[model samples]
Target: MEHTRFARFGMVCTVDHLASTAGLSMLDQGGSAADAAIAANAVLAVTAPHACGLGGDLFALVHEGGGAPQALNASGRSGSGADPGRLRAEGHDRMPFQRDIRSVPVPGCADGWMALHARYGRLPLAELFAPAIRYADEGFPASPLLAPAAAVLPGVDAALAPGDLIRRPGVARTLETLAADGRDGFYLGEFGKGLLALGRDGAAGGSGEGEYTEADLERVNADWVEPLRARAFGHDVWTIPPNSQGYLLLLALAIADRLDLPRDPSDPLWAHLLAEAARAAGHDRPDVLFEGASVDGVLASAAERRATIDPSRRARLRDLTSSGDTTYLCAVDSEGMGVSLIQSNAAGFGSMLFEPATGINLHNRGIGFSLVPGHPAEYGPGRRPPHTLAPALVTRPDGSLRAVLGTMGGDSQPQILLQVVARLLASGESPGQAIGAPRWRVGPGLTGFDAWSEPDEASLDVEQGAGWTEGLQERGHPVRGLPYGGAFGYAHLIDVRPDGVLAGAADPRALISSAAGR
Candidate 1:
């Protein structure tokens, strides 16, 4: 039976229940889905700071009244002083990934929220921020996910004893500023000052060398672009263009669209085809998908690569670090408008460089760029790095909204999304069933391998005791079982049905994941 619940007015799905509640409240107050998404994302910055916050980047696919999905790239660019030659002089072989200020970019999330709200919002910014502000000031309970992340914060209580309140007056002040002055409050006012001060101190503390001026902050702006489009499983898929790995999501789906894989979710062949599709995506990722690349060529290449993969053998895949360190959320309104959004601090706790005054943790997104001189994603002044944040939207043949979904899993983002989309489109799985079903990921067989190296062999990691694991092994595919809720992925989905009924689902793997609607 289908476990998904339908809503008439609106729906919100987020990694945290409080965020879902915050968004639903906005919808109840007659705000558009975009407005509700901002509300929920703001709350997430306060509650799930370990995963994402104001100091990170954002990518969104927003569908207005079932119209063509619009794409927003709010990703930050490298600092103007970011020179690859200087980095090599500093004795770094690859882009450094650490708890340092150098990894922090211009921070485009604040501007992202402003742009989204400005386009579709109905309520005042103050009303939208009230919920997050209240939580930061009055202190909500610490989440299970926050416990370990909080323990690492400097000079904070490592222990969250019973009855303890997670009060962050600093975060509250930032929200208050944003509510009043809009984007300027963040990029030019007090928040920007705090960021500059943090950088100065970061250099003084000797973590690493980083230089930033007021100009960098002022120049930060999110771009509105035509979404990269494709057809998969008979539905049109829309995602953000370059600087983000969204094209890879479409590439994987393109492969799936060509094959007649088994529809039975429990069959071993299903997992094999999914993993093979992911493997094909990785091989061509570095060559075809990047800034200014051709969408048609990328899709065509994906089709060619898909034909070469041997179904019974494991394909080479590098071990991308598995950090459950990003938040994805989606909201759809009664008007048939929808917003699918994903935001991140790069890794858990981001660069681990927190600004005490504003309670912000800067993202380590710079690590996404390459130090390799000839690499397409090599670091350069003011260049946007290859981003992993990808949000998605689906539309019917007539261009009506079908669903909005996304997940947080680094390079695993597209892989996880492909698996779920395949189930939804090919097997008739509901949002809940697709999200809650046992999952598998393809990558280097062993953990702790160098993320930058291509592994000589590949392994498929499946949920423990899943029948597909043994079935896959019989077909000569390397298989390993992982504990339930291990490093798989956390997905959130909102589906719009033919009759205009909307339903939402949140992955059960995340303890706080939830969906709320009237």
Candidate 2:
């Protein structure tokens, strides 16, 4: 029995129920899906402040008129204070997450969201911001997810107290200004002064060595490019262009293509294939996927090389950190348009700083550094980190967009999405079934020798007396059965069927998710 419900003209799908309500209200007011998305995003920033906020990165994959999608890279860049020379002079080879003002970059999100809204918006900013502004000012109820997020995160109480109006008067005013003047107001205008002032103070400096100035914000611009993907099983698979973790999703698809199996949801072989595909993606991460400007370079490589890969190598994945921070949202309108998007602060409560003046939190993508100096992705001024932040869209043969997705587990997000996609395409699982099914992750497996990985019979068998763990053990993978409800990525994916019927699944792991439409 399918537990999913379908709706028509649904303009909002989100990880937070309040955000979903906010967006749906806009749609009810005759707003486009994009406009509703902006409202929902704003609400999430206010409510799920620890997940992501205006002070972070906002990347979107917007599709229109059956055309190729446009990719917007809203990840902030290094500030003027981000001089590589200073680090070298200080005898530091690579930067860490806790740098002084030198580490904080000009936030690219507020402008990014405004730019997208301007390109495809209808309602004015004031109407769109009402829900978020009201919630922030009046205080909304906290969900279970937020409680833990606050507990794990630093400066939570300062950002917002549980049950308080949690007002971000400054940020709300900033949004109010954006509602009036648009993106330019945030990136190139008086808001620039506020950012500079924040930098001058101790807001961005726990390490006290930052060197940012007004010049960085003035020069920072949101980049627009073509998103890339490969057609498979009669569906178009879209992902962000390189400099982000887009290719990882494609590589997993390419690997799944190699196996060519029946779509059976309960097949243990399916789980094995997912692990193999993820391993293939993991191994290639350091090579082919990371080198590119336009996605064509790597997309072409993936298309040309969709050969069946050996699954044996998956047993030996590395133990480094697997990314576990970020947020994603997906929505499709009654007009047949679908969106696959992502936004993040790099880490929870990113950059660990919230400027009272601007009501913004900075992302700590700086934490994605290598202490090793000679590594390819070493820290530097104006260099974009290899983000695990990726969003996805799947178009079926019948001109249907079955899914739009992204997840919270950074690098592991691709693996999690891969498993769900495989469940839908080859394993014959419903949206809810695919999302609710047990899950497994590889990076976390090797990162903490004893960490649990959900989903795979191998993971379950090793711990829950299942049979697959024997296969995993025989194959030499260091496998640990995760206790139920553990560290899989928080997935938010929506599926729209033919004739405008819509259904979505927000991973139970996250408390903030909903689907509503009339």
Candidate 3:
């Protein structure tokens, strides 16, 4: 088991050791939690490009010393030229997922960094970007996670073994431009031109013409909105609102709280109840997950669903779609400020379309949209698609921050977070203990292709040592045992003790993840 790192002043946790180090450097330099989070995220873009990069979107929950946590939705919208009609006519009944350039949403990471910095940065934006720029310009060792997707990336060698040094001068120059010109550096400059060219070329190859435009790029900006809140486990839970699937976590927690869940982690009943709650919450996603949709009804419906769960039997639930390769990181500063942030390429190497001029690995977030004419998440000009990036914050009833936590698993993000949060709040587990415990995921079992397709039969995939597979199977669940690895997702967490000490943990599923503090 991993040991939690405790600190009096600050802490940073991420899926990569180098990224954690970059964030710790910011905190040491007097940067706030937001600054450290942005810095660390920048490094992840360089070190873990297969999961996240300049071309992805971001969502975060930032809680200052007092009041409720704030939500920042930095996800970009489909281009003004987006045409569901064109895709439907071309035989696409659902969103295309295999290297379809039409699935590339406007990149939002650069703008998101600028938005966060503008709100709570004590250091210059350029300084926060320096670590990433250095790593990209010089070289960084390739991680095992980056190897599988390397073939789709331009500069990265497909044959790269773990620990081989790889350099990305193109990405370095793009980062330099972002540091110098802020949001304009990527969206309105030469990088933007490169994206336009890529879009045109991709369209010419049967995707339909004019699927991108300058207006779409120039209009990009992160929006600050109210977070969805729920009371569970004697504390208030918070997550990003719609357009992001964060409410799924809140809804699941709400359902679980009403049920008589077993207290012991090893108890078969505990895993059974949690998995049932996940299925209940997932059932509401297709109807309640669009941009501008209200989740209040879904959250309120949790009570009714909770009453339907039978401890002696598995609920015959239909499966929800899942996909993604992303990064999640969190930071807490001395002043009690906390930031739970997540950023992502929709899938491994995203649209698999690497722009040569700027070296941007465009994301396929548009794949989250539907082609059905009247669907809430139907493709439309300038409309945001449903998202899987869900960052969460936990606080006491009095509004004092308690924990900053989240994970990267596409549709599995909420399920992973639900397990960790339950351990911390209900079982009183330490950060490391909660994060290191065995996990289970309930989903449709397909990724990177037709991710948002209609519901299929759901299956339960439990980590090998979870020891509850037999229990679940006996209850009628189609259980699949998976060896410990990324199938469960990489989660990072920081628990803020009432005494002001911070304890942090990084998931072992992430090969080089770490929790650093002073």
Candidate 4:
């Protein structure tokens, strides 16, 4: 609750209190939003290593005043040695999700940091990294959020008590190298060598994940591409193009837009509409993709699907758990530049491939690749997997930035954003109100599929509050209630108020999620 103490400042929001402070510190130093974002994320890598790290990939939407939003795809590609045929030959029917060499990819977070800094950073890399370095070296107390991951991860020694000091000297040294040498420090220099060795160590029976050569790491660069744009709620929403599931947000919103949403934030009808829209949008996942994908087609199809859903029809709900351990942060500088950045290590502790010398955990983002023969997302050398890190930026037609927003929920990212944006635009809710509202997720259940049935047959999990259980069942949705404040995915938001002031909110459902500004 201490972290939830919200006050108005030049807006910044992040999942960790310390990282939020770090971003505001950058803003106070006259840094641009890009600088603050990288700085905050660096701190997050240390404080919330369970979710993200220096060994992950990053995606961002950066808006420099008076220009279109910039989309940065820093996601890493599969190793040049990656071969789906080999895995298939090894007797695997699908991509493996375990901690193995096969899960590792050339990490892109370091390259992403360099790219943002080269384009928009004001402070030196050393100065920007000071806070993170200090935290990793001198140590900081762990928050409640670290418990679950620490309990399961191999080497993390999470602080037993809330105020206990936790030190990450290896991470500290790694940050120092990065600050001194930039991206090369991680990909081609000392850090890179160590990472390569760790990959070699993770090699399986005959398949070697360590096949990534120095060239693969050095060639990794964050591409600055045009953002995928869609017209929603009278504002333009921008997200990273292709190799990401961002279009799902626009598609779901477009579907919900066709409905008459209840005025009350707690109305169960909002949940039903959002759930159906999310399921419908996810149905056409391949069509709205970034590789030459179209917004018009996605919107038209979503609208058609929306018209077919009957609120009163009950669909089966199943329980399913999606993969991903990710983090999202938002920043708006005094200069009016804004950024929405999301980064991740795939599953928890990512691949569990640790560089014994540096303590860096390699990401398992390759797990996102499909093993199905001929699938667009099928595993291949030099191919980036379908990423779920969807950072969102809302801009008026005039190009004025409206909101910098995102979350850490893997497949749930777009669905959560759909509901949050709807509340912000349709009902005129504040960022905190919209983010804190009860949420629901519809996905494949742990049990087998429910009879190729209606969308409601998907497992539905809603937070316990606002009479969701009784209300949803009455509408014929097979549903279950999760504990209040459980991991329904945490959303961070910074939206521009009508009067030009910036408002920030951290999801109350999460412990230690916070916002701060000058």
Best by TM-score: 3
Over 4 Å off in model 1, which ranges?
Answer: 1-3, 161-163, 201-210, 287-289, 316-323, 444-452
Off by over 4 Å in 3: 203-208, 318-323, 448-456
Candidate 4 structure quality by residue, lDDT tens digits, 16-52? 8899888888888878888889899999888887779
Clashing pairs in 3: none
Each prediction's TM-score versus the true structure: 0.93, 0.86, 0.96, 0.91
Please write out the lDDT profile of model 1 over residues 1-518, one tens digit for every residue: 24476798999999889999999999999999999999999999988888898989999888886568889999988766666876688788866676656667788899899889888889999999899999988887778778655766544567664335687788888999998987878878777887777666664232334455678888856989889887888899999888788887888898877776998988888888877777776654555445555566666676676775666766544432111468999999989899999999888888777776677888888777778887877877677887778899999989999999999887778888998899898999999988888888765322211222453355667886457977788767777787867377788999998888887898877887888988
lDDT per residue (tens digit) for residues 392-417 in model 2: 88876544566777777766777788
The candidate 4 region of ten consecutive residues with least summed lDDT is 444-453
Sort by TM-score, best first.
Answer: 3, 1, 4, 2
Residue 414 error, candidate 3, Å = 0.8
What residue runs in model 4 are displaced by over 4 Å at the alpha carbon?
1-9, 151-159, 204-206, 286-296, 314-323, 444-457
Per-residue error (Å), model 1, residue 398: 0.5
Worst 10 residues of 2 by lDDT: 448-457
What is the Cα-based lDDT of residue 69 in candidate 4? 90
Reference-based TM-score, model 4 = 0.91
lDDT of 2: 0.65
Q: Which prediction has more favorable TM-score, 1 or 3?
A: 3
**Each candidate: what lDDT?**
0.79, 0.65, 0.85, 0.76
